[model samples]
Target: MRLLAELRRRNVFRAGLAWLALGWLLIIVANLLFPLLGLPERAVRNLALALLALWPLVLWLSWRYELTAQGLRRDAGAGAANPVSRRTARRLDQLTVALVLMALALSGLRHFVLDRAEPRGEAATGRALPVGEAAVDSERPPAVPADPRSLAVLAFANLSPDPSNAYLAEGIAEEILNVLARIDGLRVASRTSSFALRAQSHSAREIGRQLGVAHVLDGSLRRQDDRVRVSVQLIDAATDQPLWSDSFDRELTDIFALQEEIAQAVADALAEPLGVQTVRVRRATDDLEAYSLYLRGRQLFTQRGASLEPARSLLEQSVQRDPQFAEAWAALAATLYVMPSYYPDAAQTSFEQADDASARALDLLPDLAEALAVRSRIAADAGRRDEARALLERALTLEPNNANSRMWLGLTHLEAGHVDAAAEAFAESHRLDPLSGIHVGWLGATELIHGELAGAREHLERGHALGWRGPASAWLLKLALHGSDAEETARRFQDWLRDDGRIPEAVRAVHHAVAPAITDPAQRPAALATLRQAVEQQPGYDWTTLMLFAGLTDAAIEEALRPKPASGQILLMMIWSPVDADFRAHPRFAEIAQRHGLPAYWAEHGAPDGCQWHGSPDPRLECGQ
Candidate 1:
């Protein structure tokens, strides 16, 4: 009626809108200002949630307090300090405006000034980016059913009936596999790749064909009266012939040596020659209980992800059970150095403690390659470059054939700005352990660092192709390197981001920064826009790309990327390297060399006389020499 119409006056709507705006203003103040003024994250999030729900009520209340001609209405009255005149309403409105402005200013000043996040890498305690394997299209490799040696290590044939002795069976097979792995030029199937075909109806031919290997080793073991009986056979996969067969009886204590003996025999049967050194891992610990614990730790650690803490704790106990357990201590420390950034809340303290523990381990056993590697990692994270390099060199010197040491060394080279050395180290690691996700991940990442996404993609896809799908970096690089399917890439990036828990962080490195050395200002915006679009499609965008897209040239980037990694970048990007180094060589390296700008080259030369760089002054020395 008359009252309702007056409440609906044009002035009332404006006042309602103003009050709604005020509620939002209050919301901004409550959440941002309170937190900036010293509220906790939980408190800020809660406050934000509360204000979002409460703002409508705030608006309704504000609307109720507005004056209408028909009434001194609900929630509306003449101001206590005002005279009875039209100016009284104006005074009320003025008061409302003043309060709104004050709240906004305070909110802005507190929140904007205080709550800003530190740029990435600022949290030396928290970093999430990791290099990963690249991606590839699925093309089923053609079946290779030609004549070759083949054997299936059938789930140990469970002859004991007591599953507890399962490790004995597995241990026997793994020993045989390990022995076969040491042949000068053997094509033995890698354990994981071969074992993944377990329970499938793949014939010996099919298995051999799928893995691209010639021989298969089948084995089984049964324990009786603290003694185990094992039988092994080598099958020529190509011709379906059993070339060799053997059986042995041994006490439980003799099982370790027996496994190696069987492995050596299998290699001989496969016609693969063995080197002079025996294929036996030195028994670092005599304590059976500690060894068992280490084995369990290895089992759990291999699964990775949510198991990091539990595995880390179990590995720590292994070292406690036997302080001389170098492998256990080294692995535990390495896990700590890497795991915390993934589970940031709990991992930070672990990373700190790990540094001390790893250092102690290396001091206790200088011969322990694993411990040295972890110590090297700790040093690198602390920016002790020289110390880190020395530690890594020591570790590599001890275990030159170890996949882990090679991978870590390759990554270290990449960090030290030695692109050629990094690439060579990665290639060597990849050759030694091609099926390993770790090898593939670092190798692909090294390629990406060189701006060679194609090579990165190849290594990444090869890793993924091997049936390892648990890691996140592989997917992240795929999204970053491939630019055509932005929407699909964005969706894929979201899925990958949800897998944040899977990243195995070794340290928070603020390195691997993309250089800003492009001199073309005219192409800057286009390059920047493309980079931003790529970032926008990333799982988590980063500031590294800001310079990349902006095309800023660097005095250092030029020097760091000098001598380049054989133009793998141009080849992988399906583009050519602008400098002569793309397909030819560059000359900037020697001048940079005299000043100690770069380090010695570590690539595996087909044959080395050191005369490879005659025109250039020691390409292996100062200029990636």
Candidate 2:
């Protein structure tokens, strides 16, 4: 009782209360400001830990010091008897009250204003809605029916001492998924969806519900030097029950055999329940070093952008280590093919390398689905629509569960102006890889072109949430501008662009220009000027849609006719959209058709969705009928 009274008299208790309140406020401020300052998510946690560690120091200082009229001084038996101690106590009480009030206000603001201001629906929550709810929502497409034999193989936990071995763990699970995908009757979810779910806290039942799968596979890998231990379990997603579990201890040199053994065991466990009769596990490589390199390269390939060069290097080394590694060659071709999208200056060299790699992969393995898909992309870029479609069809026939093949097939269908077919293909691809932002974004874009505004908005928002910042952001802005609340949507779109670092500054500038015209018609001329400037400054990026939306059809046509149009796929797909109706009806569109090699392709095959070829004294293609 005496010590407690002494502490209160010295203002130590009041000082501690004030310190805690101030710390709370500081943590709240850090939480709000860190993201804006581009700090990582862990930075906030570190700040909280630091604040906790300083709490004892703050209390000790309060116990040992006194705030007097002469300023801070060492405590010398100061008590309630000292006027300075009483004054300091009162000040500390006031400060604590102020901090508490401020914290309450900030909390209220965050709960009522900030939270409410965020975009609504699944995107805001960053999770997919249950199928029943999503199917009933008019804004979203009907949910894909869950299959009884469907399975999702999640990324395995890496218990290895070296964190770099995480890629190997993920690679093992993905290989198992690939093996199961090749089966005749089983439906395997794409790696993107399964691996993405591993980061979330959802249970197996929730994940299965979200991904539309009936079963889930999870495992852990612990590798130390030349030895490894793997533990795996198969779960019934609907029941949240483990159906089978196993563990394997093997030498690192026998990793390939171990993978096959695990996959065969899983297949045997599921055979009776899933009606699966056989399992065929293809060996990717005989050399462990080459396989490891391939796994690392493929992991980097999935994370496009600045990682492409490194991915190319690793894949190149993998192929050099094993010339007959068809999968490595295919992965190398894919990395090179996508290099042009991120680094346009090296496009020609990259495409040539991609061609050589894809050909080698095909020569090594004639039935390689991935190589066929890469060749399909090459054909599509060269304006050989029929050839691309044929290649994609063959690839899909060989591996029906290949999401890449499905995506390429959709692009081919879109290029040929088969809107319904394109939509079906895109939807199927999205269903196969539900968490893939690319698939979702393309599906949304296709829906937008088909005039399904609600569905387009839903998918585009989901794509944006999934970290797809490329075409989806632009399409979302387009959807917003076309909405009833154009002004508010434009404002929100501008705010989003201002904060998003993933989008290029030049692209954001172009969107910034047009977004204003959504609310203020007087800004149209300025927006058009900005679009034109952007077209000249960034020839590698497609600006035709922006130009068309800005009412500059002639300039758009001219931009499309450039020697190397920005994106061949974008150029082809844009013509099918309702916004391009005028662009297509214009007399100059016939010239575009000819220059794009569409007329020859269409003549050899059949005409596109809205086009008809007229052959006589004057050879011309008529469209927009």
Candidate 3:
């Protein structure tokens, strides 16, 4: 008791208490700030560890040192004059108390004031904010459904010394995620959304809440020589409690078995029994190097724009290394199919290569969902509406959660003029991959065509927030112009011109002048003249769309019906354009029907809602004719 009293007299306990409080506050602040400052989660953890190591040193120093009239020095002997005078000790205690109170106050402010002030519900509403969507709700619950089967598999950590083995770790985690996604009754988060949060310093519970998943599977991998060590844990997001965990050390050849075991364990824990046929864990190839190269290619392909060329190169290398890898072929085909849009100079060759690769993949695996989806996209581009729809439907039947298939299916429905069906397919695609900007942007476009102006704006803004700048900007400008908000429309158009480098300066200047004229009937002649000039310079969708928006219906239809280099894109524009009422009602609409082979298209498939055929004198059906 006397020793305790002596320790109190020296204010050692008070100092330790204050240090602990301050350390806790520092950690809380660091966790909140590090991500904003672009620091990695590892940096925050290292900061915490460093602070912890300093705690004992601080306590020991407090125990041995004392402030005195003579200056700072070691504590005197117990019997000797207490080096710290009574008044000095009291002042020191008061100072420590102040420090503790300050730390507590800061912590409270951070938790209650700062965190609560963060944004929320932006996914559905699309309110403007300074930070990313993750900040929109710092403390609110995630938007998960009550299914209880929802899961998010986070990116696995690369613990290997080489660091280049990151592809292997990600491949393992992605394979497991794919397996889980294939199982029915499971609501798995998309790989893009799940992996996007890998850098944030969020806990398992926070990740679960944000992703709206009841459970989270997070793990790490360490590759050494011929063996690999993998560790994974499944946690209940609500309580932050681990439901299951396991570690595996196995040779590289056994990696597929390990992934299946992990996937099965997760399914079993959720009380969902895996069906025999549902487990399609076929090994892609025995060549690990080829598999690694394929994973790299897959990652690049998901980037979706400028990365297409490099992605194509990697996939080609992978297939060359392992000619039997059907997945690689499918992925290569998908890449080439989209490459023409990015690299227009090679458009003809790109489609041919895509066709060959997709055909080869289908030949190798007749029912491969990925291969079917790629072929479906090619058919859709070729104006083969029936074939595209059938292929996409089959692909979706094989993999119901395939967002890409759903997106393409939506496009095919739009092409066939089934607006309602197209809307449903786009909605499903958006739900399956809510964080994907392109998907959400397309959903917004569908909503716009359906004449849901407010709904379209909400989704377009959300898509912009999610990093789909190009498509979202175009759609949002349309929304503004559709509502007759001339200022907003012009603002968006000018911004687009500034950001889209591919648009020629002359084109941008013409659009800038034409934007404000869209809202005023008096300026129609000037806008039409500007649009005509722009179309002459670049006969494309944007120019065509501007003409339609500016009330030059005849000119717009003429540009669309004209035989041109971008006829494929023009056909798509005609399919998705919601404001084509005038064009649809024009007497010469039959020209479009005839030029595009719409009569045969409708006969092979059903006609879209607006057009109906009577078998007599005219097999062709036009809403106007």
Give the per-residue lDDT of model 3 (tens digit) for 1-625. 9889878877777767767776776777775675344344466678889988998888788778877777778887567787455766676668767767777787777556543342110011121221112232243564545358778887777777787777677778888988888888787877766666544535656666666778888777778897887777787777666677666778998878888888877887887533332354788789988888888888777766677788899999999998899999999999988776556556678888999999989988888899999898777666666687789899888788777788788877776677788888888877666666667777888788777888888888877777677567777766776675667867877666664434545466676687656677788888888777767776543456557667787887787666555323434444345556676666656566655455567777677766675544544445532
The candidate scoring highest on lDDT is 2
Per-residue lDDT over 165-269 for candidate 2, one digit per residue giving the tens place of the 0 to 100 score:
888887888888887788777888887777766645356676778788888887777788978877677778777666776667788777777878877777888
Residue 530: error of model 3 in Å? 6.0
lDDT of each: 0.50, 0.74, 0.71
Instruction: For candidate 1, write residues 156-181 as lDDT tens digits.
Output: 43356576665556545654664555
**Could you give me the TM-score of model 1 versus the true structure?**
0.52
Instruction: Looking at model 3, report the run of 10 residues with the lowest lDDT sum.
Output: 119-128
Best by TM-score: 3
Residue pairs clashing, model 3: 119-136
Better of 1 and 2 by lDDT: 2
Cα deviation of 597, candidate 2, in Å: 3.2
